[model samples]
Structures are given as structure tokens and as C-alpha cells.
Target: MGGKGHIFRKKLFQVGSEYKWLGNSGELKEITLEKRTGVTKELIEKRIKLVTTGIDYHLGHRNCEHFAYFVTGNMPRSDQSIWHMFTDHDPFNIQPMINNFDQLREALLRSKHCGPVGLSRGDFENAVFVSQLDDGYYTYHLSHPLGGQHLYITTVEKAKNFESSYNSIVLAYFGAFFGRGEIFSIVRQLRGC
Candidate 1:
């Protein structure tokens, strides 16, 4: 994290002294938050002190991303944690249920005035294919043996939400469409359909 011409980060080994100053790493990407005031060095140092003293360094709950967000006066959040919450692929331990896939798909499909997307079902069976169209819109495609569907997301927020819920959506689709059948039974059902 860089601000006011200095670069620093919360390193892993330094528990109590986590904040390390790395004089100007030219790789700082500026994050613009509207109505944010200039953060003073004293304020940053205070935050760092509070964090290094009070918070235990936990990868999932309190990491560098959380520190950065906290010091910047934004709601402290870890993008990695958020991503893991959505996409942890442990089959035996799926995340909490997100039950709005059908409704979201229906809404998007109804709003977007496209006929069936030309991609074959096999092209997107295992994953949701996300791509940015020439007009800056995003497309998410998911296909099954029965059919295929795509949603044109106009905003990045919606696109991210869809992508994050992609696995759940796929699972929900199969679960609803195929019932509680095993793989062979699902295949048989599909064939019978």
C-alpha cells in the first residue's frame, strides 16, 4: 500500500511490527474512493499500531487486504476472503446456499433481448464462460445437456455477483433438474427426457 509518496505493507513474519516501509515501490495502483479525505501519516501509523497490537494475524479474517481497507477508512474487507467464501470447491462442504439463481437468470434473460447464444452446450458445461463484448457489456454463459443460456450483465457488480454464484447456480440447476439421482440415473433421466 502506497500513500503520500511512501510504500508500506503488513508483512507476515513481523507480527508486532508488521508495518514495513519500502521506500517507493513503483507498482502502486491508486484506488479512488469518492468523498474520501486525504489520509495522514499519523492516522495510518495509529491504525497500524492498533492493528499490530490488537489483532492477531489470521489469513482468512484479518489479512493485508483487511488492514489496507481499514487504514484507508473504507469498510474493512478482504477480497480474497470474499472470493473464497463464494468459490471454495470442497464438494463435501459447499458454502451456504444462495437460492436465487433461477430468478436472477430469468431476470437477465428477460431483460437482454438476445436469442439463444450460439455456443454449444459442451462449450460451457464445466464452467461459466465470461467475456466482455465489444460494447463493454459482460456475458456469462452456462450450458447443460438439456440447453444453454447466457446473461448480458451491464454492470461490473452484477457480473461479479453472477461469477461468484456460478458454482452454486450450476449445482442448483443440476439438483433441481436432475432430482437426487446419481450420475448414472441423471444420465438416464436426461436420455429419457
Candidate 2:
């Protein structure tokens, strides 16, 4: 997959069932209304809240317009929407920084699937997120709410049967996809608390 570029399928994979924050406030709260209603609109609103607040807790929203505000130092027009930016731009080639991260993220949302390009499997209900990165193999986050996220960076040979708690995989082609310091900074900046 090296040189081929990362491919993010537009069809998002429902890795796990967990409650993510609603908005940029980093409040880490989930609205029960959406849960009870199970409406796509309500879910989309919840996603909007998460995007507007600029929280980095969800990997799927990392490359969003709000994420771009801090990364590129360019605030998008209020008239524009997160879906427009996130599902419109290409995120793979674009560096994963505050500046260009949004463009890349937008591209990801536009993709049929968003990821480093790899395969993942697990129990039907409890799925896992896995990615094969250049630097090391990683698990994005496990499905369901479980404490202590796990990342396994091992040899390619071992990667074939790679098993992890997370369902998000960071493919090797991305080149050390997830950086601890960068993510920490983004989370801290977005949280703004």
C-alpha cells in the first residue's frame, strides 16, 4: 500500500457502539434524546455539536473544519458546514497538522471509507478499529466503552494475525500516523479547558 496512497471509503464502518461527546466544549457528555430517538438527524446534530466544539476525542472528526481552525489558522466561513469540509477534501496526502489536517479530514469523510487501508474483524456487535502505519501497527480505538486504549507496533509478519482491543487500524503507508504529542496538543487545544 506504500506509494498507492491511503484510501478512505465513503461508507463509514461502524466499528463499535460508544457515546462520543456532542460538541466542541469537550464536556464528554451524550444527549439521551438522540439515543432514545435513534434518528439520523439527531445523530447528525450530535455530530455537528462534536465538530463545532472542536474535540479530538473522536478520530473520525480529527480532520474536520473545526480541527482546521487551529491547524491552518484559517477559520472557515460560518456559512460553510463541517460536512462540506470534512466530506469534501482529501486528507491522506495532506499532513496531519492543524494547518492542513482539515483538508485531509474532509477528503476522508468524502471517501467511501476513512482509514489507513487495512482489514479488521471481531465479534459482530463488538468490532475493533485497526490500521497499519509505516512506523508501527496501531489500533484506533476499541468498540464499546472500555478503559485503557491499546496500540501494538510490531513486525509485519506478526501484523497478519494482529489482534488488538481497538478497531481503528493505522496502516504502515501513512508513516507513523498517530503521534502522541500531536494528538495531545490537538486534544488540549480543542478541549480548551
Candidate 3:
């Protein structure tokens, strides 16, 4: 819980009823509690219970960022984990490929998990594409062979709508036959999208 410097190098362990060494200045980078609402004493108690339970820490899944989110009664997630997943270096120190829409799209298309179903790659290429909005949300577009096009905002519900109307064959970044709904669902399950 406490270390001399560089808190990331410290192993998390409970000391008696409390976590020790939490007073280090290194631990106070970006405090998110100020941005949250509906955080109550009960929520703090819940976080204390979670801490006292001796949960195993995994850097990619359960780090200090996750703990801070949990303490605020929000879903536990770590931007550090997402950053690590996309790059070899610290996110603050280097720009990751994920920041480039073209690079990210190309990388996703090359993923073994992504491709077209029942259609040739050329057909898939002409029919479907993914676009990222200025707000950072991804939108999936499908061009029908008959001349019309459908655009879906990438939310789980909208993905379901796309699935039901498109014969569940929308091209996605994760699966050949699955629609954006499947991708969003998988992301939601992972709790990091």
C-alpha cells in the first residue's frame, strides 16, 4: 500500500484494518472524485469493504485507477490498461497508434478476428466502413447493394437495431458476421470500451 517512490512498483497489501503507505504524494495524480456525483458515505464504506477484502491486484484489470472509480460508485476501468493494450510505452510519454483513426482502422481490419462473412473481401470493403466522430464515438455504415445506405451510431441498442434489420451480418472490427452490437457488447463485457 505504501512505498518510497514510484507507487506503481509497490505491491498492494492490507495492513491490519487499513491500507498502509497511502500517504505518498505519488498517489495523488488525477483525483476523479471531484468530478463524480451521487458519491455518498455508503459508497465510501463499500470501497473500504472492497479494499479490506484482500482482492488480488492485476495491473491490466485492477489498478489504482480502477479502485478510484469503484470508490466513486462508477464502473471500474483503467485508461492505463487501455493505453498499455495499444502501445508498449506509457500513454503520457508517447502518442499511441490508437490516436490515429486511419492507423487504428487499418489495424482493426488486419485483426484475425475481423473480416467479412459470406461476401468477398472486396464486397465487404465496398459495403461497410467504420468512422470515428469528433466526439470519439464510432459509427458503422452499411451500403446496400441496391443503392441505399444505413448509418448506425455505435451504441449497444443501435447495434441491436442494425443486427435485426441487416440479417445480423454487419461487418465489425471484431467478427465477420457479427454486427456492431456484438462488438459493443464484447467491449461492455470487458468494461473498457
lDDT of 2 by residue, 110-165 (tens): 43322342343442124333333343433233222332222222333233453432
Estimate the lDDT of model 1.
0.38
- CA-lDDT, candidates in order: 0.38, 0.32, 0.43
lDDT of 1 at 38: 84
Sorted by TM-score (best first), the order is 3, 1, 2
**Using Cα atoms with residue i matched to residue i, what is each candidate's TM-score against the true structure?**
0.25, 0.22, 0.26
Model 3 vs truth, CA RMSD: 14.4
User: Considering only N, C-alpha and C atoms within 3 Å, which residue pairs clash in candidate 1?
Assistant: none
Task: Give the number of the best model, judged by TM-score.
Answer: 3
Better of 2 and 3 by lDDT: 3
Which regions of candidate 2 fall more than 4 Å away from where they truly are?
A: 1-127, 136-140, 143-148, 156-159, 162-193
Q: What clash pairs does model 3 have? A: none
Judging by TM-score, tell me the better candidate of 2 and 3: 3
lDDT, model 1, position 147: 41
